[model samples]
Target: MNNIFVYCEVTEERSIADVSLELLSKGRKLADDLKVKLEAVVMGHKVTKLEALLYPFGVDVIHYADDEKLFPYTTLPHTAVIIELFKKEQPGIVLFGATSIGRDLAPRVASALRCGLTADCTSLEIGDHFDNKTQTEYKNLLYQIRPAFGGNIIATIINPETRPQMATVREGVMKKEVYSVKYKGKLNKIDAKSILKDDDFAVTIIERHLEKSKIDIKNAQVVIAGGYGVGSKENFQLLFDLAEVLGAQVGASRAAVDAGFAEHERQVGQTGVTVRPKLYIACGISGAVQHRAGMDQSAQIISINTDINAPISHIADYTITGNVADVIPRMIKYYKKNSK
Candidate 1:
């Protein structure tokens, strides 16, 4: 009830995961709203240069648990550490990255403590809730919002009676920002032996191999996206051409992927990678709510579709009414002409 805690995940490269940094950025704002300190729990082996990495995100205190067994992130060891620390701290809110590790660890911790845990939350906000059944008014509850009912409606969930309301958020959903470069925070080192047991080390990693994806649209500054309306796999080449001309990445809606117009990695929507590019160009996209949830945060959005009344037009800064075949090449030519 005193602080907001973010469970920071460590990458294979021994750096903090991007999602953890993003959570810290969001946690800082939530902590400010609740008038509480933003704390981070970082567990890894030989992890160094943390203050240089985390403090500027407005973290007030850090629980650094360093041990050789912690780096690889086993379910039992990580869960035991978090549960032990949480029992001692009794945090007001706890956040985790909706990653493989988070998916494995958060539920265990929540079950151990009997706390409510929300997963893949698209948004987090602090608000008041009134329980009509109990006639009770609760203040400053974490609103865990996500697409529900087959992505038809957005649901806002709350844990009014649970201690340390917890939620796991997807990467790229929240923007990562720096609070202040000069800000500093305190660190509390935890001894692994006191908190861990022989059972915690029941699972051991003999070897680990990582395969990185070639497509990285999440960090693209400019994105050119297409939908089922893009017509065919051959027509999607126009998006790639336009992207090439503008130095942008090519993205596709789930429909386009389902129709085999693009690779699965290139899909952008609730079920795909979320992006916040400087510029987003949607070609022949109908713009469903799920798709909008992913790229609506882009700095500027341009929708190109024959349907002028399409849902995407509502959020697009500019909407072009035309066929994708006709509009895309002209856009490519215009940008290529201007750049030269």
Candidate 2:
């Protein structure tokens, strides 16, 4: 019998990915529900250093696969490593962070393993089940639930026919486990094989640049997102002012970004950053499925739009129906007066 496996996408220095730790936190509950042990599976050069952090996150075991060949994040090599691990470990459930790398690697791994995978899943729980004569006592019985059809309905997916039930969950939807010094677990260094050759993949890294920011939107405590309704690039300054007063980062909708009002990096949609801030203030943006995919995980959503019927208003915890140009200034005034 295989254990529940969570993929730990390590950074260049071998620190665990934030989303990977979140998966372990979620996986820990799922493993307990199914009466199984939670295991962390890491792949990269010198990944053994990560094992010490997994136990505090409730992992019962850590499987380390270290190879200099696995240093870079490439689709073919990373997917090949995960596929090889699956064959050897035979885990019943596998969880991946729905990051750029995970999005690329997961589909290939799922294809190689011939299994089903749920992507950008916001919510996951063990599915309801009925006893089946053929259903293994501990396998393929849990249903994977996630938001679908633009958060209008919930879809429950089951891979009853497959060995390992796989899923890629969006970052920030699940909480990360804090390091606890009290809990301790075992770490095992595994001998893993490199299944891909240099020529097997056509992609190569020529140069890499990472955008460093003082405030990361995904980890921000407060976010103010501008929508198409913000009107023009100059008008975005008002939203930025509000963000500054509230100490929040600015986010943009796909429409706003495409209109040249903002950079694509600031867009909040399926194609942009997935954020779950404590407070998400949507100004003048109509809620589209793609837009909601990124910000719906926020702890509290407040929308200000001219159209009360805008799709985003429906999901907001509080809705103020009015033009952003008119509404935002009033809010700024009110906040300043009461914020003594």
Candidate 3:
């Protein structure tokens, strides 16, 4: 009754979403720490042979429901399935991806279950908390950590009194790994007709349209990012030039995006997309806590700023004190020269 559950999101391509896979990887660790079996819930059509994809992530139990209405992911029927299943299982902890579907489904589930829900958590761990007023001790609690007070501070939140401690994590915040390629898990088929009702199909999707993203910065091997200190929108061109020379994606801080120096899609921070690149070059970024939470995991960091004491320089493997306008051009020239 008290196991860790991950809602594995399935795409139209009949594959598990990357964020769900990453959650499974983390869920496996949490399950082990709690000495409980890791469980997964997959609701979609034609989701057979998913064991090949899931077991390696250390899932001990898989609750799968296959029905025609399950695909294209309507809000009502899908939510009904999860709500019913969660009630029967009474899990201790539940996790969801902070995607469009997750953002929609998780709150409903939490509200129905009368449980607390934390959104956009950057970190999750098992810890203990003690209440002084009640003189109560809580052990093995799920710690949902994220930025609070407008990203000025990091807050570690815990659900000491709630069952199925719930949180929705962002993509790329957790690393994806296979627990064991040889690992195996048992599957239980859910009766779709028994659990779902006609009223659940009130909302029918008529048509679906998806616009492909122009830039895939998340998967970029190298990232060259700029901030407000980059000067102006025209000055941001230097970052683009450097990116082209290095075959890297151009990223920006929230300040740069607010100043119209870069597009919103290119922003990297708590409110923006999280990225883990092999090399991250920070140009004129003062490195607020929000921005660092997104890119601190980069394999190597190099910060260049006019101020020698910029916050980003603290975490940089190499810090160059200079103007981005001058620094970026020289970088582009030297990189091109070295390539030949």
Candidate 4:
């Protein structure tokens, strides 16, 4: 375990994706544990100029593969470049953010490399110690923990025999390292690929359109989300009232979102945006691991549900047992009464 490599999937505008920094933070810890260098790999058109943004995260190396063919993120060509880099670096641990691009790219890279890759890992650790160091075989070691059975259990997966142990983690699950104005690191520019572009694959992205939301839940400071237990779509209006009072955005669980109670952008879970807001109010939302995977990193979590035994109640910093519709009106009344 000499090197920890992270994928820096960026937008065309040169803005580094948040998930990349999250990976760097997790990678920094793993690198320190294994006494290795942490490297950030950026592949896109004219990406070499963005190296200044990466060094502040405390990454040791920045490998930029600036190629025209990689700008739009095609499958075969991008996968080919990543495979070439992995073969050359042979890093001990490789991490990709469980984003739209990562979800598609990671598998291809892993398949090309012929190694095991765990997807949507919520927790990661390194330097796992064995009970019998000398007598125990080196095969059954190294733990990768993820939520299973709808987030009821934390399953620790192991891939001892694989080189470059790979995993894809959701954004915001790990903290982002703060930037330093004076920090400096090395960057290397990769030459253009010898082969020209070929669009022979069955899948090619035709167009991408950004959704228009009243408020961007991903970057919202405060989020008030509800679930099926919120009663009905009409009852869910209380969530918005509370959100307005608190200057917060509204979010919903997959169950509620899929049922047309809320829009997809407001949904928070493994399938939705990973948010680390200052405060998250989970109203009537059960503490499913999938939902927790998105907002567990919020600075403060307030759970409101009638059932004290609800799974989310245990993880919340504050819990109130009452109907969402009932408790919400009380909350609105309290907030309004306290206001001057």
Better of 2 and 3 by TM-score: 3
Instruction: Give the TM-score of each candidate.
Output: 0.90, 0.85, 0.94, 0.88
- For model 3, residues 1-340, the per-residue Cα lDDT tens digits are 8999999998867889999999999999999999998999999999757989999999999999999889978888988999999889999999999988999999988988889999989999999999999999999999999998867899999899979899999887889999999999999999888989999999998899865569778999999999999999889999888888889999999999999999988988776778999999999899999899999999999999999898898899999999999888888788888887
Select the stronger candidate by lDDT from 1 and 4. Answer: 1
| Order by TM-score, highest first | 3, 1, 4, 2
Best by TM-score: 3
- After the best TM-score superposition of candidate 2, give how far the Cα of residue 211 lies from its true spot, in angstroms: 3.5
Which lDDT values do the candidates have, in the order given?
0.92, 0.81, 0.91, 0.81
lDDT of 2 by residue, 110-129 (tens): 88899999887766777555
Better of 3 and 4 by TM-score: 3
Q: Report the Cα lDDT for residue 231, model 2.
A: 97
Can you list the residue pairs that collide in candidate 3? none
User: Model 4 residue 223 lDDT?
Assistant: 95
Error of 2 at 49 (Å): 3.5
